[model samples]
Target: MAFPIRSAVAALCAGLAATLLTTAPARAEKQEHAWTVSAGAHAPRARITLDDSTGTLNLSVTRDGRTVIEPSPVGIVTEQADTSRELRFLHRKNRTVEERYRTKSGKRLDRRVRMHETRLSFATPAGARLDLLVRASADGVAYRYVLPAGHGDVLGETSAFNLPPDARAWLGTYRADNEGQFTEYTAATAPTGEYSDQALFETAGGYTLLAESDLTGTYSGARLAHDNGSGTYRVKLADARVKTDGPLTTPWRAMVTGDLATVTRSTFTDDLAPASKVADTSWIKPGTVLWTWLAGGRPAGQSLAAQKAYVDYAAERNWPYEAVDAGWYFKTDAWDTTDPDWQTDSWMPELTAYARAKGVGIIVWIHQRELDTPEERAQWLPTLERWGVKGVKIDFMDSEAQPTLKWYDAVLADTAAHHLMVDFHGSTIPKGIQRTWPHVMTLEGVAGEEKRNNTAAHLTTLPFTRNVIGSMDFTPGAFQRVGLRPNSDAAEAGLAVAYESGLQMFAGTPESYDARPLARDFLDQLPAAWDDTRLLAGRPGQEAVLARRSGDRWFLGGVYAGAARTAEVPLTIGSGRWLVETIEDGTGGLVRNRKVLRGGDTLTVDVVAGGGFAGIACPWRPGVTTCHR
Candidate 1:
C-alpha cells in the first residue's frame, strides 16, 4: 500500500504483527554505567551497549561472542571541538515495535521489521538537549541523533566505528561519476571524499555492511574515513558545515551484520527513509530504454534521425522508452548541424512527435552544468514539457556537497512538477531517495558495464553490494564480448533479472540483438520493474542466484565468477504444474529449453566460465507448445 509522509507510522501499524509495545524495565544483570538493548528472535541475538557516563556506544553479536563495534563516542562535531565530550546522559527509555511494508518499486516485495528501539536522552552542560535514537534488529543496528527545538551549526558527526586489529574491509573508491570499483584494504586509510559511504567489513564470525540511510535530503551526506593509526573509521561529512535552526533529525547511521545473504538482503536503508512524497504515482512508468549513444558517436549521437531509428527498434521490440544521450542540444561533429540552442531545436520536437506516433517515448539528456543558472530554467524546463519528453538523464554532478544536494532537491522538485522522470549519472550513490520521490528511477553508482574493462566478477559482486542499497543502472544487454570474455550471452541475459532498475537501459544496437532470434525473443518479454525480488543464493564476487516476479510470471537468473561451475537452484513458486523456459550458455549461442515441473522442482544449471543463466516460469496451461533451441 502507498503511504504519504504524514501517514507512514499509522500505515505501518496497520500491517504490524502486534500493537505498539510499552517500555520494558531495566534488566537486573545490566552492566554498571551501561544500558543494553537486544534484538528479537529469527534475527541473530545482537546487543547494543550505551555507556551513560562517556556516551560511548558499542555493538556485539552475542551468538558468536564477538564485538562488531568497539566502544566509540557518538555525537555531532562543531567548529569548536567534539560536542560529545560536553554532553551528560540523563536517562533512557525502551520500546518494542514491528512493521511490515512492501516497496512500491524496489528489489524486495515486502519487509517484516521487528526492532528494539531505545531513546537515550542527554543534555549539554549549557542545558541544550538531544536524543540518540537507537534501533537494534536481528540483522543490524542503526542510530541517529535527534535534536530538540534548538541547536547551533553542525560541522560534522563524531560517530566512529572502532574495529579490531585483524578486521578487513572492502573499500569502494569514491568517484564523481559514482562508477569506481571496490578494492580490499587491510587497513583502510583514505582522505575525505575518497571512499563511498557504504563499505563491507569481514570479521571472524560473519560479514557487516556499513552505510548511511534515510537521508531525506536533510543533512549533508556522510562517508567513513579510516585512521590507520588508531584503527578507527570516523564519520566524514560531505560538507564542512550544515546549520539547523530549531528541531532537526540526523540521518540513520546503520550497520547490518550477518551471513552474506542476510547482510545483502537487509532493507534498513528503505526502513529509515520517510514515506513517498508523490501521492498519485500512477503517472510514474518504469520500462526498458534503448540508448543511441552506446551505438552511435557524438554530434547527433542520438540525433533526430538516429533517435528515430532507435524509436523504430524499440517499437518493434515492444520496449517503452528510447533515450537520447549526450550531444543532443549541440552539434559536436563537423558533419552535423550547428544548432546549440534548445529554444530553436526544431528537431527535438519533431523527434518526440515521431516517437509518440510510434508508441515509444523519448528521454533527453541534460548536463547539470547547463542548468546552473536559475533564469535559464524558465525557458529550459518548459520546452521539454512541451515536447513530451518522458524523462531526463542528468549527468556530471561531480560533488556531494550540501550545495549540490540542495540543487538536486530543486531539480527534482521542478521536474516532478513537470512530471518528468530522472536518472542520475556522474553522481553520488543513492541513499534511498527513490523511496521519497519515485520519479528518480536509478543512479550510476557502481562500476557498471559502461566501463570498458568491467569484468564478470564485478557483475557477480554487484548484486550483493551496491545493488542492495538502491536501484543500479548497469546498462546491461551487450551482445559483443570484451577481450577474453566468456559466456557473454548468458551473463548479459541474466542481467535482465539480476539488476534492479526502474529504467533498465539495454546496451546494444538494433543489429546486434536482431542477429540472435532467441535472445531477441527474451528481451522482448523482459520487464524493467519487478513486483518482487528474492536472492535464492549468493556469495560476493563468486556467484548469485536471483528470482523476480512480475504479474503471474517468475524470472530466475544466476551469474558466476571467472570459473565454470554448476549448481541446482530451488524455486519457491505457487502450487501447480508450471512451464519453465530455460536459457544457458551454449557452444555458439545461448541454448533454450522448455520443461514441465512441479512447484518444488529444482533446476540444475551449468554456467560456462565467466558466464551466467536466465529462465522464466509460469503456470502451465493446456494446449501450450514448448520450443527448444
Candidate 2:
C-alpha cells in the first residue's frame, strides 16, 4: 500500500510524453497561440480558453456562454526561472477521457466522468520544460502543471481566479487545521486575508466552487489570498518552497460551475484523483459511530465503564462502531510511549473484546506526536491491531506542509497494512485523499459540533462549500444545549441526513437520545454511505434541502437559518407512489406524521428560524400503507 512516489511520477511523465508525440498538433509560431476546449457536444457545457497571445500564459472559463472566470495569469515559478513569461509554445495534444468507478463511501456510489483534456507543452528561454494540462467537464474546469523531468525547487504558483465585478462569495479564513467560520462577502468588500482551499462564489452565470484536488505528499498544500477591492484570488502555498527531484506534478486547481444543485452534487474533486490503492476493501465499513468524548468530558468520559456503556448503546441501535477519544494512554514525555514510565490503559483489550461480542467495533484515538515516525507506528499499530481495534483516530496534525502531508501518506499505508480504518482530526481539508485511501473514513476539518460557533448559518453553508469536495466529520446530532448555538431538536436530527460522512459521529449522550424515542428511531435507520444524492433547494447561509437515497428508500432533510419560511420540496426520486414518514420541529419538541403520495408531489413544511425537518419515503406497495423499518 506504500505509494511509489518516484515510479508513479516517472510513469505519468512517460505516458504523457508518448501521447504528446503521437497525437500532438503541428507546432505553432511563438508569437501568439490560442485554443478553446469544450466539455462535450451538449448544452450546459463548460468551455476553457488557453491563451498566451500577450506573452503570458492565461486561462478563462465559461459555462453555457456565460463567463465564470475572466482571463487570468497561470504558470509556476521555480527556483531556476520564472516560467510565467518568455516561454516558447512547443506543442498541444487534445484527448477525451471517459471514466467510470465505484466509491467505498460518498454522496454517490457509482460515478461516471467525461472530460475534454488539452495538454500544452512549453519551454522557457533557459530550456526548462513545463506542461500545462487543462480539463473541462460538464460541471467544471481544472488545470495542473507537469514538469516532465526536473531537479529544483518550486517557489510558488501564479494562478489567479478572476471573478466578475458583482460576484459575492462565501469565504473561510485560512487555518492550518482548516477549522473556522465562513462569512458572506461582496467581491469588493471581501477582507484582505488568507482563505481556505475551497470557496463558493455566486456569479452572474451561476454558482462556481473554487477548489483544489489530487493533492499528494510530494507538494505543499495551497490557499487563496484575496486583496480588498480586487476580485482576483491568487494561489499561495503553505510552505516557502517544495523541493522536487524529478518528474513533479502539481495539484489541480479546479472550478466547479452550474446551479446550486449541480455545484452541490458534483464529484469533480474525486474525478481528478487517483484510483483506490487498496486491493481488497471488504474490511472497510462505513456506518454510524457512537462517540464518547463529546457526550462527557475527556479522561473521565473515556473511562472503561463509560466506553462500555457507549458500546452497549451502539449495539442496541445497530450502530457499528464506538469511538474512544483521547486520554486512554499516559506518557511521561512527547513521543515517549516506549519509555518504561509510560503506561496505556489496561482495559482496552477487555473493552474491545466486550464490544466484539455484541457486534460493535472499537476505534481508539492517538495523538499525531505519538505516531509521526515509522518506528513509532511500527510499535503501536500492530499492538492495537492485536487488541481487535477496528480503527484509529489520529489528531493534532494542524498542518498542510510537505513534511506533514508526507506523514499522512505513511500513516495511511501503515494503517491499511494493519487493517485499521482512519479518522483524521485537526487536519487539512480533504483533497481527494479518500479516493486514494478508501480506509480514510472521515476527517475533522470544519468548525463542527465541538465549536461554540456552530450556528445554523454555518451548518447550512457547509454543504455547498466544504462538504462538496469530500466527506466531512461534522459530528452532528447533538441534543444537549450547552455551549453550542441554539437549534431546534428537529434541526439536530435533520443534520444526520443532510450531512454526508463515511463515519457519522452522533454527539449526544445515551440519556439524551433515549429521552427522545422518535429522533432516536430516525438515527437508527439512517445510512452513512449513500447510493444517490440530490439537492432539492438551497442557497448558501440561508437554507438547504437535500435528498439522499439508499436502495429504494429516499431520505429528505431541510434546515432554515433565517426567519421562519416554508420549503416546498419536490419528491422527484422516481415514478411511483411513496409512503412518507416525517419528523419536524413543533411548538414544544417535535412532531411526527405519515402520508402516502406519488412522485413529483410537493411536500411543504413551515420551519422556524434555526429549525429543520427530516423524512423518509419508501416506494408504495399494494396493501402496504406504512413505512416500517
Candidate 3:
C-alpha cells in the first residue's frame, strides 16, 4: 500500500504545496564591556572612528608600518540562553582551543575545555596582540582593533564549536555523507537545528582564509524541512581556482532566508554610489562570449612552436576574447606571478595587440589577493591596462563573510571604475550579480572542465543548484577528454549550446577541439550570447535541463541522472527547425544539424547515464538537410 503513486500524490496535494525555502545562519557571539572616551591602558593602538551620523564602525589596525580598516560587522549577535545545555556544551569546546583561557596558577584548568565544540576562530600574531577597545552600545558591544601585517603570518583559527549532543543541529543530504552541524529541510522527520554531514562545506587558500558559519542560521524553520538547508557553502578540494598575492580576510559568515533576499557582501561606505557614478565603464559591452584560455597551457612565446598560435586559434574560431587563465603571465607554473620583475609590456602588449588584430580581446589572470591592497594596484592595474588588455579575471573570491566580501565588492567597483571587466573564479554560485554589474562577465561556480575528473553525476547535478543562481563559466565542453576516459561525462557540444551565460568558455586543449569531431561542429556555429533563458527542470548538482533563446534560435540542454524517465516537454512554437546535439547513455551522437518542422513540437527522449543532451531550436539555414522524421 506504500506505493510511490499514492504517497507522492498525497504529499503533493496536501503537504508539498508551498514554495517556501529555509536557509542557515552564521555563528555570532557578543560580550558587554564598559567604555569611556578617555584613552587609558595601551591607549587603544588604532583609532576607533565611529561616525554615528552614518552608522559606520571603522577601526584601523596597524603593525610595523601597514594599516587596515576593521569594518564593523553588519549585524550584532542576538543573545542566546547560556543556561541551555547546548550553550554549556559549546563553552566546553572553547576551553581547549583558546590558549589564553588558563588558570592564573599557570595550570590548565580541570584538564577539560568548554566551548571547544563551536570555536569559530581566534587569530593572534606573534609579537602582535589583541588590543580590545571595547564599547557598550544599545546595539551591542563594539570591539575593534587591527591585525598588523607583519605579525608572523597573523595566525587565525576558527572551529565551529560542535559537541556530540549538538550533532542534530544540521540537515541531511546525500553528499558529504556525515552527521554534522547542518539544518536539512528536505527530510520528513524535520530535525530542528540538526545538520546532516552533507550540510557542511569548506573552502581554503593562500590568504590562509577559513570561514565557518552554521548554515541552519540562514533558513527559517518551516523552510528548513526540505533541500536539507537553504544556503550552500561546501568544501572545495582540487579546483584551487583562486590565487592571492596578499592577505585576504573573511568576515561574513553564511546566512539564509526563504524568498528573494538581497545578498549584501558589504554595503558599508558611501564609496558604492560615487563608485557607480564616478566610475567610467564606457568600454564594457555586456553580451560577448569569453573563453578560458586554459585549454592546455598558456604557453609563452618560447613555450610554443608558433608564438601566435593562441591568437590564431581565436581568430579561426571567432572567439572574441582569450583568457590566459591561472598560469598565464608566469614564465614558470607559479600561479601568483605578481613579479614586478617580469616585463608585462612584452607578453601582455604583444598578446593583446595580436588578439586585437584578429578582432579578439585579451584577458589575463590577476591574483585577487594582490587587488585587495591599494599599493599593489597602484602599480598593477595601470600596467596591464596600458597594454591591449580588456579585463582581468579575479580568482578565488568566496570569503562570503563581511571582511572579504567587502574587498570583492570594492574590487568590482574599482575594476568598473578602471574600465576593467571582472570574472570571479573559485566563488559561490551566482546570485543575479551579472544583472547588476555586467562587467562581472563570468564566475566559476560549477564543477567545471577542471573537474572532469570528478563523477559526471556532480557535473550533471549543477544546473539544478548552481545554474539556478546565475551564470557559470563551467570551463566546459571537451570532446576529447571523454574519448580518452569512458566516463568523461563530456557533454561538450550540448552545454556550449545550452547553459545560459554571456561568458561561456570551452576549456579543452586545441588538440581536443580539432581532433574531436563534434567539438569543431559545435564551435563553428557558436553565437556570442543568448537573448533569453528558460529553466526546464531540476536543481544544483542533482539533475537539470535548461533551454536558452538566442536570436532567431533556441538551445535545449539536458543534464540527467537517477532513473531514465521520459520528460514530455511540449514546445510553444511546436513548429521550428532544431539543430540537435545529444549525449545519450554516455555515447557520442548527434541528430544532424538538420531542420525539423513539426506541428506537434514535442520532445520525448530516453535520458540515461549521469550525462546530458542539448540542441538549438531555430530556423534551419537554407541548403541544410531537413530532419523531418
The most accurate candidate by TM-score is: 2
Error of 3 at 580 (Å): 5.8
Output the TM-score of candidate 2. 0.92
* TM-score on alpha carbons, each prediction: 0.86, 0.92, 0.55
Best by lDDT: 2
Candidate 1 per-residue lDDT, tens place, 279-332, comes to 777778888888777667565454577778889999998899998987777654
**lDDT of candidate 2?**
0.84
Give the residue spans of candidate 3 off by over 4 A. Answer: 1-185, 188-282, 286-294, 298-307, 331-346, 483-490, 537-543, 562-568, 573-600, 606-608, 620-629
Score candidate 1 by lDDT: 0.73
Q: Report the lDDT tens digits of candidate 3 across residue range 74-112.
A: 211112111101111111111222211111110011112
Ranking by lDDT: 2, 1, 3
Listed per candidate, the RMSD to the true structure in angstroms reads 10.8, 10.9, 19.6
Task: Give one clash count per candidate, in the order shown.
Answer: 0, 0, 78
In model 2, the clashing pairs are: none
Query: 253 in model 3: Cα distance from truth in Å?
Result: 13
